[model samples]
Target: MQTAQRNSLRLLQWMMVASLALPLGLFVFASAVSWVSIRETADREIEHSLDVAHEHALKVFETIDRSLSEMAEIIRDVPDADIVAREQMLHLRLKRLVTSLPQVKSAWIFDAKGHALVNSLVVPAPEIDFSDRDYFKAHVDADIGTYIGEALTPRPPYQGAPFFGVSRRRPSEDGSFAGVLQASVFPEYFESYYARIGREPGSYFALGRADGTVLARFPIIDRDIRLDRNGPIAKLVAANPMAGLITVTSPTDGIERRLGYRRLAEYPIYVGAGLETSAIRARWLSTMSQHLIFGAPATALLFALLGLALRRTRHLHFEAERRQQAEEALKHGQRLEALGRLTGGVAHDFNNLLTVIRASVDLLRRPDLAEARRLRYIDAISDTVTRAAKLTGQLLAFARRQALKPEVFDVSRSVQMLSEMISTLVGPRIEIVILGSEEPCFVNADASQFETAIINIAVNARDAMEGRGRLTMAVGMAASLPNAAPLPQHPYGYVAVSVADTGSGIPPDQLERIFEPFFTTKQAGHGTGLGLSQVFGFAKQSGGEVAVASEVGKGSIFTLYLPRTAGSGRSRQPATDAAAIDGSGTSVLVVEDNAEVGRFTTDALAELGYAAKLVGNATHALEELATGAERFDAVFTDVVMPGMSGIELAQEIRRLHPELPVVLTSGYSHVLSEHGSHGFELLQKPYSIEQLSRVLHRIARRDVGQEAASASS
Candidate 1:
């Protein structure tokens, strides 16, 4: 028994030792992997910085080379005598050239004797001798084509900042060096550009000659510094002259860096971009410290848990199961609570609308109601019903199921037209600025809904600003969304309408919930909170999206992005003369699922001088049409119904009748929202009598015109 006990004790000790060793090994391996990843990411960042610097250098050099070539061509045929004689004219030309190029400071034409023939700085060429200048001397003996000389300070008469000369050897007829045409390029130009591109802390950009002559360095050193020919960078260049990566200490600053260097393809110049090794290492260390901070504790906790688990496996399992059950119960309760809030909000708004309608109807029912009072009550009821419809429409919009009549229209022009209305809506205290591209940006969407969305956003902006601030609405083109996701099938790209305001701005926590229905930050009665929700839903339903950005103290900007349409199709302007829309007793087939609505529609149609017949569904309507009992001018149908939807029915009627016009009407149809009106006129639900009459009359007139044309043909 003693021998067996001893062996078991030894086995337990070995197991514990193995467990500890395994975790330690894993921690070390993970640390190694993280280090490698961090280094690689740092290297990639450095390389990217190098690429930006290289491209900027190329652009600057190309511009300079082109300018030099143009100047060379202008003076190519002119003799030295003419160049001296027409000094003022040549100087003016050079001045114009320099003025055009922001990078080039000045231009100078030197004779073979190194006398300044013409200078852009002064009309009569300055009595300055360029014989001593490096650029002039470089071109004196040999035709070096184009020479980029080292940086030089301006001499006495010619005064400005330190600038490097880019010169071309002016050849004589015998192929001998005649003179030099030099353009003074300010080092500050390249340095300023370098400052913009290399923005990382401890980052550096250097423009240098192939022979270690430093022309410019960003972070502008107090004194000029050149690279040593025997340095690591020079050795790296000697090995790979075109481009390379180097890890070395700066001879000037003595700070070590990981650098990426590139040589210009044509020019004998190099552009180097680097981040201090300390920064890179610090980044790596910071990342590693984070891993250590989390991983060490986690590993330690895992070890403690594993040890405890070995001792009480069954107990731990029971505890885990209990915790999981508790979590699930908590989540379920939260979901139910959220559902209650949503349903409660919707019910409250609808009940308020119903109460107004009920009170209006009761007042209208008074036995001795005054004519004005009765009209006022009736108008109140109408307005209440419209509000109710709008509330439901907003809900449907949030659900992305609102039926929309999409048409191609210019977003810029729409904003411009609505600027006056927006100004009034926001109030006098708020300054409204309308900005848009000179070129029209077209988008395919419901124009009315688009206007509503803008107004909704503007109202929110007005409230956020407390009615005093600047509200700017800008429309422009965007290639992709903020998330960098590519658009689909829209070769014309996307149109972005951004509404910005100087307001109190939204909290980060509230931003995520801003689009949720009835989620408002305002006090009671201040807002419905469905404004942004409507904008969100409308954007999504239109194959677009809305995004917002905000800071607590700064303001907020809401941008709606819609697919751009290449066609320049503007929204049809409302007919100014009502007489143009003539019904003229045109026969119509009305397809409605509701009995009351169908009866009301038919009566309204007849009252508007259109002979009408009603059917309960598309099947009955189609059957009636198939019978050919009467020639119908158009088919007005509801979109959503039991069996054979209005859109499908319209397609069927179009196929069979070919000449009949189909007008679709809907309150909210998922099909209609997802797929548009299918080339049919659409009348949204809750439309007024005037709106209904106008639609029917327009279709009727169109049909009559088509019939007349057919008969004539």
Candidate 2:
């Protein structure tokens, strides 16, 4: 009790010090603030103006861009119109665009020879040639995308002012460059918009090219606005093209202004909007002149007032600080408590899985076990391993380190195949209905992981229904997903797999955090909270997204969106019975650092009628190959080992033994990224005997074919 009293007294003393510090600090700050310069005010104003102007510029550019793109699309898809009729329709449309948006000087459609096929303004269009124009020449030679060229002036009476051509090259039916669909936008359009950016007199706003060519400027001093590449503003813009503030003296007026500038991300143009620093300083000085008079008096009064207030609030301050500390301690405890709960939950789930495995193994140890009972134990063990693999897969996915073995397959077909399995898993009480679109829904991703994600979602829905409701899996095409990341068929289509359930839906508070790792709404000891997280991570890593919508007491729909693929027709191959395939004394060198694993590989190879040799590392394998290359027909290597990686060993083998086949195996390897298996055969770990037989057969066939070709040569 005496120790508690002493601690309380010390806390009170510290609270008193803190309470006094605030008022003293405020007094010192108030006194010192007058001495600090006001230069940043000008920069702040300039930055605000630049940001606003840049936004407006993007909108304007987008408007013009969309207009041109639409026009081009229309002309490109003109659907069997005669040359004369198409030209007339194209002329009218272009004219409408130019009139609607005053910024568009003209839109032109021209053939490969630069002959003007149609123009927006020049009716009975003159036989004008744009052959000399860089924008046209660029498309004619080789244009990968839209080209923004330097300013060009009309030869005759057409808008004496210069215009920059933003052109997209037209492709022929044969996929060859055919023509150019050009939008010539006037500089005056940008200049007019920029004029409103500066409220102060002599202030400026301008747009320049990435290559330091001034395109347009406000307060039109003259037409001769182009400067040398080494000019101050040009140099500044070139050095920091994305965004920054730089003081530059106007070449026309010789007035240095604080400028805020940004380079347009979509286009090769830079925009700068600014106000004169001198004008800003004058305005600030005028406003602050009155405030300066009361500084000393105000500071003195404030210090005295705070001293009295602190004295009166001493007890309150001590109580409040003590209460705050207690609240913070409570929150920290709650967080730690929450973490402990999570740990306990994960540990309990894993322990249950391990118990399943352990019990299954013990059952398998009984010599008197019947064949059917033994099979049941094996299935249970396999199921537990699968569950454990899923847990770790989710962990790896959350860390963004799970390697993908992507192949294109139809999502609709995969769903159809999984329907029966899902029905059996969910039990008879839950009705599984699959609603597939008539159109093909294809995706490029790891088929196994994709199947796992769908199963996880399906299982989640099943649980939500408490094993007694309808679960509907709807497959179709989606235009946009919930996230901002770009996918395979961006802005066009995506393969969507939605699992919806008529269950007691989740509350809004819990719904938002469903995708977070180890976040579950299930009762403790029932879930590891990694199911939905795996779904989330797999979708994201495959360049897609997962979206969930739930209504309380009604139902919930969980959708996984994957990028659309053109269906590489790479279906999952059904493994044949391993016992049926004869390895026929084909020599296989088993490379694994782990003795148990290496022994297992060799035993399996021997069981399949293949003569096998065991090597501990890449060094031994390389030495074996060096001494007798003909003795080994293939190398079955583990991906991650001590000295040299399997991929590196594969590279070495490819260099030395061009004719020999190398098969790499890994459940998950840091070194075996998707690219590592490009030209080499891969046997995923936990592979069935049938899958092993299937890969070996394929390798043998490939070897025979290579040998035949070499003999023919």
How large is the C-alpha RMSD of every model relative to the true structure? 17.4, 12.4
Compare the candidates by lDDT and give the number of the best one.
1
lDDT of each: 0.85, 0.79
Q: Candidate 2 — which pairs collide?
A: none
Q: Each model's TM-score?
A: 0.54, 0.57
Q: Please write out the lDDT profile of model 2 over residues 345-448, one tens digit for every residue.
A: 56876898999999999989988999999999999988887777767677667555677878888888899899988998888999888999898787888898
Task: Please provide, for model 1 over 1-713, each residue's C-alpha lDDT reduced to its tens digit, 9 standing for 90 to 100.
Answer: 99999999998898688776865786688778877886787688878988887888888888878888888888886898898888888888898889777788899888888888898888677776789888888877778877898899989865778989999887567887788889999889888888887778878888999999999997688887778899776887899999888888888888888888889889999988888888877877787676667665576788999898887988888899999999999999988987887898888888888898899888888899999999998889888888888998899988998878678888988888889989999999999998889766988888988999999999999999999999999998887767755545355678999999999999988889999888898897777778999999998888788999998877999999998976698666744534333466788899999999999988877777778899999889888988993478788899989999999999998898877778899887877777778888989888776787777766664567877899999
Sum up the clashes in candidate 1.
Answer: 0
In each prediction, how many residue pairs overlap at the backbone (N, C-alpha, C within less than 3 A)? 0, 0
**For model 2, what is the alpha-carbon lDDT of residue 383?**
82
In candidate 1, where is summed lDDT lowest over 10 consecutive residues? Answer: 574-583
Best by TM-score: 2
